[model samples]
Target chain A: MKRWLLALVLCLSPVFAQHPADSAFSHIYVSIEGGEQYPFGDLIDAVENSFYGGVGFRYAYLENIDGFILFDYSYFKPVPEGVKIYGAHQFSGKLGLDFKWKAIAPLAIGAGFVCDWVRGDYDEDKLDEISFSNDLGGTLTDNETEFGWFARLNLPLIRKETYKVGFNALWKELWTLPKRSETLSVGVYVERRIW
Target chain B: MKSFGKIVKSLVAFCSLASVGAFAAVDAEMEGMEVDQRDDGTFLVGSPTFFYDRILGAGGLHSESEMWSPEKLRQRMLLDRMSILPSWDVMEPSVWIKSGNELGDMIYRDFITAENRPTNRTPILEGGFRTPSFKGFWVTGRAFQDDHFTTSNFSYRKSFVDDEFAIFGENYPMFSTMYAGFGYSANSIDASFLAGEEYIWIFSESSRWIPIHYKPRLEARIDASNIEATVAYEDAEYQDKRKKEKGARKELNGSVYYRCGEACRRGMLQLSAGLAFRAVDDSGMVYTHLEEDRAFLPFVNLRFEPFNNLAMEAMFAVNERDWLVQDSLEFRPPVPRYTGVVVGVKNISGTRLNPLADGEEYFDGDTISLKADGQMNLVQGYTAFSDTMGNVGMGGRVSFWAEHGAETFDVDRYVEDDQMVYRHGDVERINSWIRGVTGELWISAWYREMFSFKALGGFERVDGNSSRFEVTPVEFFTSFTADWLLRKSFRISQSLRYRSDAQWNLRSVDPLVVKGDWYWDATFEQQFPAHGLYLTGTLLHIIGSETIETPNAAENRLRFICTVKKTF
Candidate 1:
């Protein structure tokens, strides 16, 4: 697989011979946030807090179109003993294209594709000790790279000489092959533009 | 060496051809659009997408039970068995995630529960992930954990074709119309019940007694393009019975589409047929109920629109099963397969709505539209082993509403056994059932008019014809609400509800004697406008008694709870 990917990349390199210079890139930003989820009525009541951080960059490829790349990672930490411990790790990278419409200054509509990786874990110590190997025991691990597209709208709220508040509405579809699974994600991003 | 070489070549050839066929089916469904990687190297296009769900919960336990007086005991041996409820702090956490492209998809989920009781503490953990290959292959792995044991499992899949045929609407691009794949999964379950329920029953009984039960199952599903061919298998073993239970079933199903020749025509029609067979052994060697039967089913689905915003859908199915083997333990032939059918319809102006709410509506309560939906299900089957007796019934659920936050009506009937036990006839001869229906009436203009105050009331009656009695449940509900801009955010005024149920049953030991009574429960809730947060509490109590001997079985009480939530 490694050799195959290397060969494919080598063959495709010539197609991108006219890559834009680094100076064309305008800004790069990163942020971190956390939140909790709770269930409603008659159901068990519980709250779980999750934290995550990400990094992204934008390049002015053309006067009307801007190219951007972003990477985001998130994971849930272990909590309260006596309860089985479960956690997940997600890494997503997005390649975006933004079209600037002159309705407002520094505002643009963007669309892109995202490639992501997800991993999950569930402890099964109790199952192993009982020798119940029929259909239920093992340390589980799977890693898959998902490829898909995304669309976003970027609104610059606080524009300044060196600082700007970039509010973004984004939608993404991640496709994992073989089974050809797809995931749709809608989210918001607040970024600080820095050269 | 020659034989080994032949087997290897056959396996490889089978896999290669299967993958190719599966891909071809998927590609044909793609119409003419080619799948390509972007300059940044990301997969684009295909089918609808799916995502992950993160869930968590926590709750407290509280219960009280009074011991019965000696004079109230119906039998001396009744003292041998006692009931004790476990009260403890319970916490459960679960999560599931699925993602994939054209080849296949993977699903991973985990369930964990922890209980903090005064006497003993128990916690359980389980999770698994499964995915199918591009052709006709599948793979699965799982893990489980608890106080006494740990376990895991792994499995694989193989298919016969490259792709299956499928159709897509104009809104979505389509390429090919056919597809097929094969898959397999291995799972393991390991946990000791401990000296739990068995110990409790053993010590409580005066005479020597032994408790035994076991459940271990291995299941697999396989399918071919067009649903015309499929197979499912389950192999299980029971330690207590020292037997193995295995069942293998296969079906050939397919659907044809009409109205595809002209752009002027719309709506689609589908029809399918299939057969299935199941078998179980009498010895404890396998984990089955030990009955064998064969069944045939046929179904149809139709979609049509006479006018804009007036779309209709209807579907029907029927199943017939014949007994193939008799149960040695029960001394009877397997019960005939039950038959069932479902019909549904929806009528409203705004039928083209997304599954998820695009935005929240505070005062109006989400998007408002008038509509009605309903379904009817019916079945006929035997009540127990060793008996030639049987029962037949019909049940359904229906709902109706108007665009301005008004709604009403529902009825549901399901199979139940309490009625049969109480009737005491041929425990096997009596058929068991429960019927319930709910109705709602909302007066939106009552509270501030702009602030709707809806009233809801419903009555449900359940009868045990075999036992000669019925129970009715009555309930009242009201709610007030207000919305801010297009449902972005708003506050719910409040909702108060009261409910009561009447219970009637013949004595288990003496079918001649009948007892009846009632109980009540209520709920109150306050919610945030964004569909993001809310707090709710409830109260419950018994109202009256019918018999002096039973005195309604318990003391009147109340429960208080407050919960707050946020979503991401």
Candidate 2:
């Protein structure tokens, strides 16, 4: 009778243990965010401060590290008084890793590499003037892809088992073919656990 | 040797394998944790004796309550949305210099002459400074000089909110901005004639936001000018006896716009409508004929994005002109009165009047008459598509333009009896109409970091009926451009353009036809990032057919241009 009881208990242990640990590991989440982004370096000379929105997916593989992928889109106008750029668009994608401190509750630091693309169309005649006079060359209208890297910090205000509300600040630099563009952004997000 | 495709595939496969390995570790850890916690707290909570003993039962119980309730989550989300508002201010200053030269026979139009084709060399110089201050205040000035003309202009603008007067909120002022400007221009037509004009203008505009989605703006401008001319004779001293005309023009314009979504975002729709009215008066000249004129302009524009990667835009406009002076002596050359012929002048009694006599009214067969009323209508549309990555795009545009007008002219007839006669009653009224359609396709790619290319092809067909003349239309046009970045601060660019043949009206029985030409240009640019200075050199029209036989076709010449700019 004792041997039968031990076998039964061992068999049922795996089933009961799956519920608590599943919440900590192998977790999937989706988030939506909106914020403002400011240009720096050469990018500031070409464009003004802009607003952005993004959607992201995160997978927590370890208790202290989470992997995430995101897509962001932003809009702004060209800088300087007479620049003709209007409704300029910037798009970027990122794959990154986040480091968390369980003792600090919901605070995490992240670093990542990104693929970025930017494009804007203005009056060709006016753009010619800007290009020739300002030395922007072919960057204004060409949909060029750039490789970049970024660092970010996040703090969750309300951390629940199923959902989290947080804000993040990030700084990024994209190495254009012949120039460098940089941006600093702060955003608020709402994340819901999916799996 | 490995292809780029193979390399990319290999990298992706490697990443997938690494991800699988990482996930496998998590799975193994999960399995271990499950085994360790197999018999955790189950037996004590399920025992019958523990349930009977209240103290043990209470000690064994474990509660599973959520860390945050739904109500608390909703409140935090609301607080996040309300606290996120960002604003910034920027100030930038820049200086630039542009210089170029032209060598050709250029066609110039005057108030009286239909065409003046002159073979000459022209050098141009332009420079400017701009300073944009905080709070939307700015000042700018520029000077331009060429072989035939010199001009300078200065402008200042100030924008502020009147907190004492609010339209929607205390921060939203009812009054918006004020601006003032002055300009001067002098044109020298060889050693025989010169013309000068000076103008001063002031403008003010106000905007108000209604509710949350609509904005309306009203603007007004008042301009005053003085125009005069002089003549120099070979034997006689130069004289400035021509009449001095003072003119004033007033314009009022307004616009309203509506937006249906967040600013500067996709999936948004925007619509705008605008209208303008202008009035002019310049009737103080004696030898020159002047008239009062007015115009009405209206337009509508719409933009919408029905899909994430596609956009469509359209615009329509109507313009009208009334009582415009077609030929003014103030802007034309004075006809010589020493030809031993007397021509009748309308609105003036004397047949032979010296133009060099100051404050004296003289007709000299120069008639100032009203031009025909003109109207125009234009419509345009565009559609564009871009990939999700935004690395490549294609777009197309179509436009239709139409104009209709008529003009009346008084001509001088010379009889075989050595007498020149002017007849006001023999008025010639000419009706004119022109309509055209243009279509264009453009594509660009920046697939690589070091090189990129852009191309545009256009086709246009224009047809017109003029009581006086006609010409053939442009049928096709194309341009291709490429850029190469050799380094971080240096670049080289090249472009080629081709245009189809076009006809020119020579005021003769048959028009002059010119064949199509191809033009090529190249440019090199360098930047000093440490000092915020940029320098560029360009060679234009380096290779092309140098000669074409149009009535006033300019001889093609290789031109060089250099520019220097500084930014702060």
Task: TM-score chain B for all models.
Answer: 0.31, 0.44
Quantify all predictions' global Cα lDDT against the true fold: 0.27, 0.38
Model 1: per-residue Cα lDDT over A121-152, one tens digit each: 55555434223211211111334333545667
Off by over 4 Å in 1: A1-195, B1-230, B241-270, B285-438, B442-457, B461-499, B502-568
**Candidate achieving the largest TM-score:** 2
lDDT of 1 by residue, B241-305 (tens): 11222223221111222212234344332223333323333342221121132223233334455
Using lDDT, give the best candidate's number.
2
**How do the predictions measure up, each by TM-score?**
0.28, 0.35
Give lDDT: candidate 2, residue B61. Answer: 12
Which residue window of length 10 is worst by lDDT in model 1 chain B?
B55-64
Native-referenced Cα lDDT, model 2:
0.38
Instruction: Give residue B307's error in model 1 in angstroms.
Output: 11
